[model samples]
Every structure is written in structure tokens, then in C-alpha cells.
Target: MAHALIRRTLHAAAAAVVAATGLVAAGATTATPARAAVTCGVLFDDFSYASASDPALAQRGWHIRTSAGGPGVPGATWSAGNVSFPTVDGQTVARLQATTNGTGAGTTHAEMSLPDRRFFEGTYFARIKFADTPVSGNDGDLVNQTFYTISPLRYAMDPIYSELDFSEYLPNGGWGATGPTNFQTTWYTYQPDPWVQDRQYSSQSRSIAGWRDVMATVSGGEVRYYIDGQLVGTHGGKFYPRQNMSIDFNQWFIDLTGHSGGTSVWHENVDYVFHAKKQVLTPAQATARVNAFRAAGTRHTDNVTADNSCTPAETPPPAGGTTRIASNWNNKCIDVPNWNFADRQRVHVWDCTDGTNQKWQFVDGTVRTENNKCLDVADAATHDGAAVQIYTCNGTAAQQFVLSAAGDLVNPQAGKCVDIAEWNPDNGAVLHLWTCVGGANQKWRRA
Candidate 1:
């Protein structure tokens, strides 16, 4: 979301001007937009790291962000390319020769387990060809796209985090018949949310011989899965809101503690990957930046600021054309650029312009700066002269501000409307939460 640039003092000055002009307050803005503009791009692929460090593999969207806390191998590790992509029998097979070491679940890696963005309706497609041969003991190692599955160790993590699994069965070695292929799209949470799981399908006829295209599309909160471009199953509400995380891909072996002779089950022949695109890219010129890096085999350029192609901004403009004077007095709007200063210094408002620190968002019930700092009560006591300060955004009643239907900001906790913190008309003054007394201090109008 684009952050709004406006200093707290300027906001107060805007309010004061509204009161001076005798404009009626309208409380909060109505009509929150339903959809958001999304930024789409091509992430990296494994080929990007063919030249550099192993950690550089993460440039492709997968990460090893875990510290393995419990039992298994006690730490996180990335598997090197030991598995070969040779054709076994008449089919191509991809296998990983590495094992995991961590607490409980072997060695684990944290990946971009989920999408960082949310979508109300769109189709996600993945085409994969699997190995016909199932290793002796380790089956169920490879599963489809999952959310909370970012980390291998699942139990201790917060369940509120979401997860999705497509397939998770190992190759069957019994008989000469082809192993059964299974697919699923399920949501998992720490707290049992029954409505999350939607579909699962199993087929013996589906094997590693041919290309299988899997598609997932959501509409009206319902998810539909398509195989080979044909609708196969429908899952409704088994989904969660879209999140901003990266994608993860891994291949590992599992132990056969229960089976005879402990056959090491393995998955092989993994190659040819693609991610669905939401927007059609622009002319070749627009893709030049991406293509340049792609051609360089550089994988990615994370530190954009050093590229010398970026621009810097000057001091941010005042809020709503309202310039605020600074003051150390209490009970006033502090003039913080971006409202990220630790202490809520009182100040007055003035004119508007561009500035890095003027942006703000009223998150939950608290007014927070665009930089993610919070507007806070300097102390616990809710007296008339209580000081206001800037801190991190935490959902607290003290931080919960009541913007009147008329647009005036009110602090019900202090039972007062925000007034000049020190009652100073100078450049800076502390902004504080106070009772709503319907005075000029309590009046504010829209910018």
C-alpha cells in the first residue's frame, strides 16, 4: 500500500483549520476498496546460482530460515545436487541424495512457503513429471505447494499461519504395478479450523510417464483444481487470506523405521519449472531491467540502492499544506516526519510537500506512521496533561483512537479530544490524548 505523507502536527493543524473554517466532521472515511493493486514479476530459478555460493540459491525465492529447535538433526541445511536427473526405465526421474538433520523431522529448510500477496480470483498452475520408481522406505516426502510448510518442523509453529499441500505419497515398491499418484489441496492451522481442508484425489493410472499440469484457481472463496486443463475437484473455503512470503522447493529422503529392511524411498527426475503470471508484461523495453540480470546469470540484484539507478527523496512535505512548529510541551501533536520518532513531541501544523516521514496509517485502532511506528501514551495515567509519544504499533486501548464521525480524533481513554500538547502555538508541541470536551481542540476536518 502507498503510504500517506502527513506529519501529526500538520494533521492537528489541518484539524484546527477545519474547526476555524467551521466545517462539519464526517467521522471516518467510508468505502474501503475491495481489491488492491498488485506488483507482479518473475522470481529467480536454480540456474541463477550455477556460478556462486550455496546460500545464493535463495535468490530464487526459497530460503533456509529455520534454526531446528527440537530433536532430529538440531540445525538447518540445504541439500546439494546429489540426486541425478537421468531416465530410469523409459521415463525421466529426478532424485535427491541428501537426508535431513533437525529436531523431530529430519533436516529442515524454511522456504517462501506462501505467496506474499493475496488474490480474490486467479489460477495457479504447476506442471510436474514424477519418478515411476519409489525408493524402498521413504515415501510421502514430496508434497504439493504448502503455506505454513515453509519450515520442516510443524508442531511448535503458530497454526494461525496457513498451509497448502498438493501431493505427499511415496512410490510403492510392491508388485510390478505402477505406484499410485495422489494429489491434495488442503489448509492446515495449529488451531483446528475444520473449514480449511477441501479436496484430495488418488489415481493409479497417473504415473511419471507423462506431463501432468496441475491448476488451482479461486473464485468467491472457493478453490477449484484442474488436471490437464480439465476441472477435476472443487474445494470451497479451504483457503486463507493471501500472504507475502516466498516459494520453497526441496528434495530429501525419509527413514523407514516401521518397514522391513528399511528401504530408502527416493524421488527423482525433477526439472522444468514455471510460475503463473497475473499481468502481461510490457514491451521488451520494460522487461530490460529483469532481462539484463537474467542474461548476466546474476540471479538477482537485492541491494537496489547501490545500483546507482535509484533515486533519493528530499525532506518530506508538511501535512495537508499544514506546517507544524516543534514544542516539548505535553498534550499536543508531535511534529514527526513519518511519525516514527520514539517520543511524541508536541508540535503545530503548516503547509504540505514531499517528505520521507509524513506517511501514516491508522492500524487496527491506533494511528501509526507509515514507517510502522506507533502513537503512544507516554505514561499509564490518563490525566488531562498525559504525554503522547511514538513507539511500535501494538493493539492497545490506549493506542485506539476514536476518530469522530465528523473526523475529529478523540481519545476515549483520556476522555478528551487531542489538543495542542503544551497549549503552545509555537513550531513544536507535544500531542496528547485527552477527553472530548467539544472545544476547538476537539474539532478536525478532512484534508
Candidate 2:
């Protein structure tokens, strides 16, 4: 961990090769280091299962190292026994161990992957550990701790392939490079025979020999890498993944340059991983999302999404800023009665009064009142005439309301527009979600 920056040359073809082989890449283009609060949207897993073959794992699309494949060198083989789940820090973590039983013939790699293959774009998070030396013995071996996405080839030399190595940590140096270097490689394909598929990647040399929070955000055609909550590098352009990928984590040796065939075990610990598809949260926002999940006592959840694509908002909020939201038809101001913060509190149209309750902030694809509460569709209802009430904002599409060009507040997730009950303009007339009609009750004017 002595070098400041690994010189990652932008040889399109060599980027993928460098990453796969654990070569310390020197960047041709300067990668701006990000220093900010870490945050993201996530798919979370705390590895609380009893074993790799636990029923909960199959239900959640996880499988251990049963498949024989080498992402490393030819001698760096894979085996199932090298993978285990043990308590680390205060929680059970997915532990991938690569051990060489005194000979290269018995070396084994440990990997776990999501077999669902539905993940495409979004932020990715994993709290992990990178060991520079063996837990009990040895210090000169080369090991890789990786978190990546891959669209496995359906056939030999399949053209429909993609991969994004969000992180490839070479803790003790591999190939011809120095130790403690990290990389983020965006690959479209690595086929070099009939066709040449290239990649875009960024890398740096630093000391990360302990538990580190690694993050990646894939949104708006850009791949941003983060350490802890600060940005490290960004990758984009045509090499952005062309298809969905299965999330993967593995620990293996990069033994082509030097081999340490010692009878010792090398471990990589992952506390949890979080993925939020179709959502690109800022570092602070991403942290909050994961914190909320932990707060809710979630050790495992597949209820959010493992879908193919993320549907980002098409239109941004109007640039005018916070204003008085008055129904164009009745001229009454949309209000969060008495500045209510309670869930399901009825939001109504009252006299403008210019009070905080009557004022609204249109920001980041959602509408917020005086505080963190947003106008939420009750129960995230999709059926017609669902009530629109005040609720604490949790960054769900249910709370995301888009003001349309035709003048209606629409919740795209529900495919419903915000409307007033029965066209009423009374002081307590509540708001609801109905089919968008571009009608008077659905139209609002910012004052």
C-alpha cells in the first residue's frame, strides 16, 4: 500500500485484462477522487443464514462455489468448501476463503453469485474486508477480493455478454503490480478472437487492508465508484453494461506472476450488500437508505427488486422552486393541515394564508411539505380514488409525484394523478389519486 495512484492506461482492450489479472492499472485520464458523505439505494443482505446451502439462500437466488471456473489464473481453481458463513464484528458475514493446501494443485477459489440474473442498473453496496496476509500464516501471496456483475456466456464466445467489476482489490500485489490497489472496470465484452470487446476502467493504489465500505452507482449512463462515502472514480461511455448481470463476490489468487502454495487460508469478509435498482442515490442518500434498512431489522430482503432495468424519472421538476400550490380550478391552496407530520394525515386545500402548511417544495421527483413528509398515496394504492395523505418520506416511488406539463401532480409508480375529492374546494377537501383527465380538479398552479 505504498503507491499513491496506480497508472491505469486507457488501452481499451488492456483495461479488462489488467483488471482480471490484478495488474495495477495506471489511468490515462485523471480520475477525480470523491470526498463526500456516502449514501445509496440498495439490495441488502447481511449473510445471517446458517450455511451456504440454506433454503433461504436458494429462495433469495444465492448459490455458493459449486461451479468450477477460474476468473484468476489457470491453477487458481474453485471449490465449494472454501466458502463459509461465520460471525465477524457483531454479525454473521459471507466469508469467502481461498486456501492453498501446500501445492498449486489443491488451490481453491471461493465465490458466491446471484443466479437470478435480473440486475442491470443502480447503486451497489458491500461492507467488506481485504486481508493482506493469511489469517494464521504467510504474507507474500497475492489475493483478490472482488465484487462484480457478469452476464455469463450462453454459448462459447457468446456476443451477448457484459460485466462491471465494481471492485477488484489486490491486497498483496498480483501480476507485475504493487500491493493494495483497487479497480472499477466497465466491460461490454472481452472476446478477443472473432471480435474485440473492450472496457473502460479506473484504479488507484491505497491502504485498505481492513473492513471497508465499497460502493458503486450505475445511473444515467455513468458508473461511479466510492470508498466509504467518498467518490473514487467514474466510468462511462459505450462500455456501460449492455445487458443484465448477476451480482458476484469471490476471493481467489492471482498466481501467474508469483505463487505462494502455502497451507494457509486467506479470507474476505462481507458484512452486507445493498442494491437499489432504478434509483441513483447520492452518497449521503445511499447511506440513509441502508441505515433505514438496518433500522427496520432487515437481515434479508428480496421484496424490493431484482428486475432487469431501472426506470429513472423522465422529467425533472420545474425550475421555479418552492411555491404555493393552488388548484387552478378552485384557487384554494394545497395544504398539509396544521403542519401535520403524522402518517395518513389528510392533506387538504385551504385558504392560502401564506402559512408553511400551504407552502410546498417541488424537488428531486417528489413534493415535500414543511418537513421531510411527502404527499403519499395511501398504502401505495394503485386502484382508482386512492387517498393522498401526508407521510414521512422514505424515497419510494409511492411518494414521488411529478407535476405534468398539463398541470397534474402524477405519481408515476401508481400510474395515477393527484386529484381533489369530488372537485370540492372546502377547507378540508382532501386529495386523492385518480385517472389523469387534465381536468380542473387535477390542474394546479404554482403561486
lDDT of 1 by residue, 390-429 (tens): 6654434455453444334544344345566444555444
How many backbone clashes does every candidate have? 84, 19
Candidate 1, residue 55: CA error in Å?
6.4
Candidate 1 weakest ten by summed lDDT: 1-10
Candidate 2 per-residue lDDT over residues 1-447, each given as its tens digit: 222222111111121221111111111232441111111113568888888768888776676755444455455567777777899988899999887665557777887777455567777888898787788656666678888777664433355567777788887665346757787777755543343446676777776878888888887788898988888888888777766667788887766344444576889999888777666767676666566556535566443333342233322234334688888888888888777678889788888887878767654455777565778888988766898888877656577665654576767555556788898868889888876655688888777
Per-prediction TM-score: 0.38, 0.66
Candidate 2 residue runs with Cα over 4 Å from true position: 1-65, 72-95, 100-108, 113-127, 154-160, 192-197, 217-237, 255-263, 271-334, 338-343, 353-381, 390-413, 436-447
